[model samples]
Target chain A: MDRNEPLDRVKNRRDSALRALVSGVPYMTWLGVQFDRRGDELTAVLPFDQKLIGNPVLPAIHGGVTAAFLEMTAIVELSWSTMWEDLESGRISPDADVPDSLPRLPKTIDFTIDYLLSGLPRDVYARGRVVRSGRRYASVHVEAWQDNRSKLIAQATAHFLMPRG
Target chain B: MMVGADDAGRDEQARIAQQFIGAIPHARALGMQVEDIGAGKATISMPWAPHLVGDPRRNVIHGGVVSALMDTCCGAAVMAHPERPRSTATIDLRIDYMRAANPGQGITARAECYHITRSVAFLRAVAMDEDGEGPVASATGTFTVER
Candidate 1:
């Protein structure tokens, strides 16, 4: 059901839909996480906050906060991908109202993260790749970096139980 | 077990745990309080807050908050170990979410450093809500122990 609207209008709608979905989660808002959406893809941004410091000696970002950032990125990415499919099939309408139209994200079943380097006290960026998404389950691999994409601060693999359609 | 536990050792453990918690800003922001600490074991609790809610419709606490609590507890356990590791950092952590934490009830995490080598300590932790029969989540992690 690709409506005969201008291409740019449809693209704008998709982008806004993605942002609304991320903002619907209160914890995400509290963490000050923002999404950079281009078309349907996204890169999550976490701004530096003094209150996020875990080790006062090292002045490093809390490992737990990093995990939370990665996990949220994965869930939001998965939700956006599912919504894209639904949009193509006309299963749902473009979200005119924000929170009510936001999709319910999957619940994490398990997450394993390896810290390659200490999370420096700086703004961090993360992206999630959906390894596999099926009717009942999904798996994602996420990477977080500070200055460069090649130099990763942390990476993780997570499995989630998808919400029923 | 009580006969072998010395009063001085217990006092040192509790003091170390408090110091570690006090130094962390996120732990304080979340209002986490250390309940007890004894050689290689630490228990911490956090009160429920509206900002911590993840599933707004169901009013469930966020999974990230649970992981953060467990991570802090595990690190405290390592720092308060009888071996007296001067510093520690999480190298790898694996968390399994067993159930959603009920909102309004507080969450507490207990962690134990079950094993230690020269440079690494192994820890496990469980996060429980006030009314849950079983744990809400469990985590196992490895931390670098700097003597």
Candidate 2:
């Protein structure tokens, strides 16, 4: 029994679960969001599209669109992190009977967004960090950037209600 | 630029503002329509769509979509103000979800530009379904005058 082989299997299962979650929400797929997984970190990418532009004068991406992207990123990050934690703690089997619904979707309680700069018409990247997770709620901080990570286009914080398994 | 002070001029300004909002691609994609625009208030409506559902089990619209609707409504309210600048940009927005919206019901958001200074505009909005007594979400935000 190779240790690395088991880890690869788990990764494959997690990836498939993530795909189903994204495709389940039509808006997420419509925005052309793609997830990049690196060990414990997950980043969401929003490909540029002409239809995302809100202000044609400055040709900037819609502020609402950017906020929505950040919100979705936070939820996705929380879902994956929770799933891995459950698997490690033996709370849920990695090979659970459920195929389409491995991770439960969290409900948003509140969301706040700060627009530091206008989002240009280009690929945007976002990463969410779980600030804290309690029995009933989880708080996440997310940052979205286009050209550079340090120079963020927008930052958001959201609190979500975790569903009981 | 100083906004027109006459009735006709104000009407013309409202028309222009409506057109600008209509031209927003994302707004169009969301099926948003300008319900009304006055001095410092604007109302926008989003029709129900199956694709907007966030929770399949409950069939509730995503909170993000509601937030977007409120944000857009607030922006429109600011732009429709009699003392509006040439352009405006969202500085920050805070939204609180009171509860899940009813499935298959259109959401309407009404926003008011309560205060305006030299460089910033303050806005507050409430989103509701058919029942106006209970709000789906409420938002407060500030926009920078880009003139």
Candidate 3:
């Protein structure tokens, strides 16, 4: 096997694992989470639901719910890579019991949310990009938009501390 | 300076806080129930669920849930005072998860507005999954009151 072969296989398995993970979130399932990956970019599309409505007149999606959606999406994406390494090492399996210390990235060192436009009653999408990934820390940038307008509803740059095993 | 009280203003504060909860479904789904309010302070609680589990084996509530609970409680606590009419934005929230949220437990969020000066409100909350004894998480939140 080529040296890069294991890397490629792990990446592929990561994508599949992400899909299965998103399907498990009941709210994400209700909203229709669409996973789109091209290279290192990950996009999660969440359809709007009436229950997420925060304001009737302005029809803004509740901020907390929107934040939750973004946080979960980012965590799932990060988990894929970490879990793949564990699987390759035979430390964990999809069917096997998850260890007590399930992998954790550094706690969010910080996150800044800039609410540019309010999320309306239409499907919203969040695009996340790994700006930099290192041994002990990783930085991710995420943007939420609608209809390709890039309304820039919320942009978050989070620093995650990677756990040292 | 003498502190003044307005009965109507107090009633309006309660209504606004209630509307805030009514606006968010997940807050409702979490069963976040407000207990009472007094002098720029509020207390709220939410029930724990199997779905709330983060590390399923340990049955801990995800840290994000703890953050959200603290955020909600702090925002309400800040706005509970009659004098602050404008909306507030969370400038920053820092949480320290102390222990795992035991399975089959509910969380109570207790928040108090310690100071309100000019345009900033300082608040703190502890989300207890059992009673008020052992906390699942504790947080300090800062809010900027819109002028």
Candidate 4:
């Protein structure tokens, strides 16, 4: 019924799945990832440190870091949101929850990114929003912003393949 | 103080550069070599691979590989800096495909950090082949520097 209960259940039951999600990304570990979720939107922030500098004057960030951050956000969003049955099965009957018929996994089919503004030093944040969680697929719009809210560093749209009956 | 262009400095740089490029297996498989590396700048190159095809039918290399290459080289540039060794995470990256890479053409990436503050790091990289007039793809990214 409570949020912590589900997280605990996942931790106890799906350890391998969770570990795979995190361990698969060796580079993500290199960048020190911090994860968070609010409602349906999932976010991850990587704090800026000295080792990330490519040029002293320009100080470029790594593209791998961005790709990994987006992927991680997607993974968390998919894993945390349980379909209706999942919550009901766990003994939590909340009418607000979506139906149980919807599949849990979202297979990433394709993604496109556009670089609007250059990212500068400070905290880098990625917010992933579910565009459409359909029967066969799920799409998301992820926006990454840096220190300045007005300047968007990168934006990505990802399509995932959802399991179907 | 200005460091002279001595063999010692050059060799040290080469060693450090090798360490950065070694992180990516594909880059190693492609025989990537670092042309130069300084406090915050790096240039890495890998010869074109026929096997790096993206679409087998069209013989186009997958955009994923290009993205990976861009990420790897850009990360190397970031790690080459002689500052704190805090981990760096990629917050976001965008790659624009200027043109498809020529089949059998070697590829090279030049990446640099435009600006870095206490929390965020900014990066840009250009990938090109021998022709050099135009880039195959250009990337810009943000990274969070871990303390």
Number of the top-ranking candidate, with TM-score as the measure: 1
Q: For each candidate, what TM-score against the reference?
A: 0.93, 0.91, 0.72, 0.47
How close is each model in CA RMSD to the real structure?
A: 3.2, 2.7, 5.2, 11.3
lDDT of 2 by residue, B28-141 (tens): 888897777778788889998887777666677777788788888888887778775777789999999888888778899999999999899999999998766699999999
As for TM-score, the candidate ahead, 3 or 4, is 3
Off by over 4 Å in 4: A1-155, A158-165, B1-11, B23-26, B82-84
Write down the DockQ of candidate 2.
Answer: 0.75
In the range A45-98, model 3's lDDT, one tens digit per residue, is 777877666545565776655665666566656655556667556565442233
Once fitted onto the true fold, the runs of candidate 3 whose alpha carbons sit more than 4 angstroms away are A1-15, A23-34, A83-117, A129-141, A147-151, A157-165, B1-5, B8-20, B89-92, B117-120, B131-134, B144-147
Q: Score candidate 1 by TM-score against the native.
A: 0.93
The number of clashing residue pairs in each candidate reads 0, 0, 1, 36
Two-way DockQ contest, 1 vs 4, winner: 1
TM-score, prediction 2: 0.91
Ranking by TM-score: 1, 2, 3, 4
Candidate 3 residue lDDT tens string, B1-147: 001135545455555565567656756755677665557777777777766655454555555566667777877777765566366666656566566677667778888878777788888777787755677677776777765
Ranking by lDDT: 1, 2, 3, 4
lDDT of each: 0.85, 0.83, 0.64, 0.60
